[model samples]
Target: MADSQLALFSALISLLRRLGKLDDNIVLAYTLERGKKLSMLSLFYVSNVILALFALSGMNIPMYNAMRRCVPIASLLLGPCIYPQRTTSSIIMAIILITAGTITAAQGDLDFDFKSYTFGSLSVLTQALYLLTLQRMGSDNKLGSYKTSSAKTLTILYVNSVNCLPIVFAVVFLSGEYNSMKSYPHWSEPGFLFALGVVTSFACVFSYSIFLCTTVNSALTTACVGVIKSALTTIIGMYTFGGVAATPLLIIGQLINLSGGSLYTYEKYRLQKPASPKPTKKNSSIRPRKPKFTKTARNSSKTTF
Candidate 1:
C-alpha cells in the first residue's frame, strides 16, 4: 500500500512537471555529473524500504525497536572510518551506554530470531550510512547551487518511488498476491481501503520528514532523533499491541537510551559550535589623548619647543 501510494505521488509529480506546473530543473538536479550523490540517494531509499519490510515481518515490535537503538553507536563508529571525523571520550561513553541499554531492553523479549536480528542490524547500518551520505552531500557547496534541500528530498522521493515500482510488481507477481487478491476480492471493503490509505499517508509523511531531517542536520543528530522515535514507538506499541508489555528492565533501558542520546547530542553540538573571537589588545597609539588641563605645563612645553 505504501509503495503504491509513493509511486502514485511520484507519477503525479512527473505529470505536473510535463504540464509545466513544476520545475524540471529540480527534478533533474542529481542527474547531471553527480553519480556518487545519486547512488547514495538510491541506496538510502532502497535500504529504508527494506527496513520497512523487516519491521513488518511479524517480529516483536519492541524487540526490533530496541535492537535499532544501536544506530547512534553505529553512526559514531562509522563516522571516523567513513568521514574521518574526530570522536571524543564523551561520545564513546554515550555509545557504550546506548549499547548497554539496548541489550537491557532486548532482555524483555526472550524469543530472539536470528533472521530478525540480522535484518535489524542491517537496517541500523544502512540507516547510518544514509545519514552519512546526506551529511556529505550537505557539506558539498557545488551541490548546493543545484537545488534546495526540499527539492532534493522531493527528487529523491520521486526516484525512490520509480525505482521500487518494478521490484514491488515482481514481488507481488512472484508471491501470487495478485492472484490471491483477485480471488479474495477485498478491494470493495471501505474499511480496509481507508486503513490502507491512512497507513500510506503516514508513511509518506514519515519518509519526507526523515529526508528533511537528514538534509538539515548531522547524521548523529538524525540518529538521536531515531532514538526518540524508537522510544515513542515502543511505548505506543505496548498499548496498541496486546502481546507487548512494559517490563521494569525495559523502562530502565529506555531511560538509559534517552540519556545516552541526549549526552551524544550535547557533545556533538559542543564540538561543532563556533569558537568565540578573542578580544584583541587596544592600541594606545591609535587613541587620541585628552587635552592637558594645566596651563603652566602647556606654557613650559611651548617654551622648550
Candidate 2:
C-alpha cells in the first residue's frame, strides 16, 4: 500500500517536472540512455523491497530491530571491498562495538527462531548492498550533470518507483491481502478511507525524507539514522505494544550501540572535515625599495640646484 502511494507521488513529481512546474534536475532523454546503470539501480530497489519484507516476516520485533543495528557494520565492512574505499581504524573499532552490542541485546531474548534470524541477516545484507549501490550511483560522473542534490535524489526516486511499481502490484495481487475485503463489516467505511489517506500521505513524506537523507549525505550516515530510528522504535514499542520488557542486557546493548554509532559518526565527520586554508606568503624578494644616492652626488646636485 505504501509502495503504491510512493509510486504515485513519484509519478506526479515527474509529471510536474515535464510541465515545467518543478525543476527538472534529471534529463529524461539521458535517463534511458544509461541502461546499464539503470538496470543495476533497479536491482538495488528490488533488494530494498525484499529487505522490508524480510523485516516484517521476523516474529520478534525487538530482536529483529536489534539485528538491523548490524547494518552499519555490514555497510562499513562491505563498502571498502565493493566501493574500493579505505576504512579507518576508528571505523573498524566502531563496527566491532556495534556487533558486540547487537549480540548482547539479542542474547537477552533466548527464544530465537531460525527463520526470523535468517531473514534478518538477509535484510542486513541487502540493505548494505542497496546503500553501496546508491553511493556509487550518486558519485558517478555520468550523472554529475545534475547539479543539485535534490535533482539527483528525485531522479533516483523516479527511476526506483518506476522499476518497483510492477513488482509491488504483482505482490499485492498475489498476497491475497484484500481477498476478503467485501466480507468485512465496514469495508466501505469513511473512517477506513480516512485512515488510508493519512497513511499514504505519511508514506509519501517518509519516502521523500529517505531520498533526501541518502542523496545529500553519505551511505554511512543513512545507516546511522537507521540505527537511531530503530532505537526510537524500540522505545515506542515498549510503551505502545506492551510485552516489550527492557532487560538489563537490552539497556546495556542499546547504550553500547548508540555510543559506538556516535563515535563512528564523529570519526567520519572528523576525517571528512575540510582542512583549514594556509596563510599565503608575501613576495619578500620583490619588495619596493627607495632609490639611494651617494653623498657626493647629492651635494653636487644640491649645489647645481
Question: Each candidate's lDDT (Cα)?
Answer: 0.72, 0.72
lDDT of 2 by residue, 97-177 (tens): 888888888776656667778877887888777777777777764544677777777677666666666677666567664
lDDT of 2 at 120: 79
Candidate 1 wrongly placed segments (more than 4 Å): 29-37, 51-58, 141-144, 175-185, 268-297, 300-305
Which residue pairs show collisions in model 1? none
TM-score of each: 0.78, 0.81
Rate residue 205 of model 1 by lDDT: 77
Residue 74 miss distance in model 1 (angstroms) = 1.5
